[model samples]
Target: MDERLSVAPVVPRFAAAIREVAAVTAFYAGGSIGSGDYRPGISDLDLVAVIAAPLTRARRDRLRSLHRTLGVAKLHCAYVSLPDISDVSRKHVNWAHERMFRRPLSGISRAELHQFGVTVYGPSPAELVPQIGREELATAARAELRGYWTGAVRRARVWRTDLHVDLGLTTVSRAGVTIETGRLITKREAIDRLPALGVPDDLTDEIRRRRAGEPVELTEPQIRARAVVARALMREQLTRLLG
Candidate 1:
């Protein structure tokens, strides 16, 4: 632990909380914490755990309480059943504080889990997650670029926030890189490579400034323009591949 892990100070408490969950067999950390790129007050702790089965309402509520007690600002702990760890076809439901959603672990997530994700409890993530092929990852990345992100930008009605500027930059840059190379890069790496990703310097600076907790505002027009530009960049990379 580099001590930057938001949960590091509370690992014992986190450990205590997980142990209380009788269903949790294995827990692996992900996101920035997994990559050791944690930015104080910015990067949240991401955890993926294998459970005996789908967490019951009582168990879910109990786990949520632990997060409050732990006092970690952003903790994303998702649960996959023991049988579902290797079931790539199965969509797993994970609980992030209050939200419960279905999203199968992506190849990028697997790469990080296996390469650097720390085990909070139970077995190693490598033992639980199967190896993912780069081709498969590339395919998925392309699909996301064409579908989710293309829609994501257009649907956004808000800007000038940390999530709108800083988070958006990371996702766009990461998606662009992954679509082209099928490799997962850290958030910092994504920022550093934004120029090569065809991101305009103004937008890049927007992310940097927002990340530093500066107060910045972008008009609705500016936000929409940034979204269009990002989508265009992605489409360009996507086009070159086919050409």
Candidate 2:
């Protein structure tokens, strides 16, 4: 590995955590530490591991423990199986997989995994896998933000300062439909564009109020109602754009 590739200091520690997972038969792809292939504002560690199946209770517990330890600021980890790559479906996964070789520390080479096409690490693949489209996935992601925003609104009303801000950014990113250079519009700019996407006037108002340091709280019922609408709109846009 190149000295530059060893940039992510948490690689060794993360690999150790994977080992504690019990059934993980093999591990690879540890070097893409700071790669922009995932989401923005994700300053956490993202890793992929191949595991051996029949996960024991102890193994699950170990994963939870690892989560508690790594949850500290500046460190986060997400584990996925090899076959799950196919489920991501987006062309970006191919691009991301290819870029793995450029990272500072890689247990798995970009070429090796792709050449094999689909590699199975454990007895079987993980139960849940991320399935999405390049176009549709973006829309679906935005819907999540919309739901979070509603929650942010309620949290603000209740003076839940921490959650309000957290969900505020999340909501804007989801409901904002403008895609600039292949990204959702910036949170600052999304406000202006929400109306065009048919977002309700009140939701936008709440977002603005929160930005201005107002207390807003969106109840669970309110969030669910908005999420239903947001999901429908996102699917509509994605269908048109993706087609």
Q: Report every candidate's CA lDDT.
A: 0.67, 0.42
| Candidate 2 local lDDT, 116-222, one digit each (tens) | 21222332222323323335535455444443433443332432333343344334443334222334333445555656666677866776666446777778787
lDDT of 2 at 242: 37
Candidate 2 global TM-score: 0.41
List, residue by residue over 1-243, the lDDT tens digit for candidate 1. Answer: 434345355543565577657377877777777677766666676777778887777977776666566666566666777777776657776656456567777666777787668777677877777877878777766655565545544554443344654555576677667666767888888888777767788877877776656767878787678767765665555455433
Instruction: Return the top candidate by lDDT.
Output: 1
Who wins the TM-score comparison?
1
Off by over 4 Å in 2: 1-7, 20-42, 46-54, 65-74, 82-132, 158-163, 170-243
Record all residue pairs in model 1 with backbone atoms less than 3 Å apart, i.e. clashing.
none
TM-score per prediction, in order, is: 0.78, 0.41
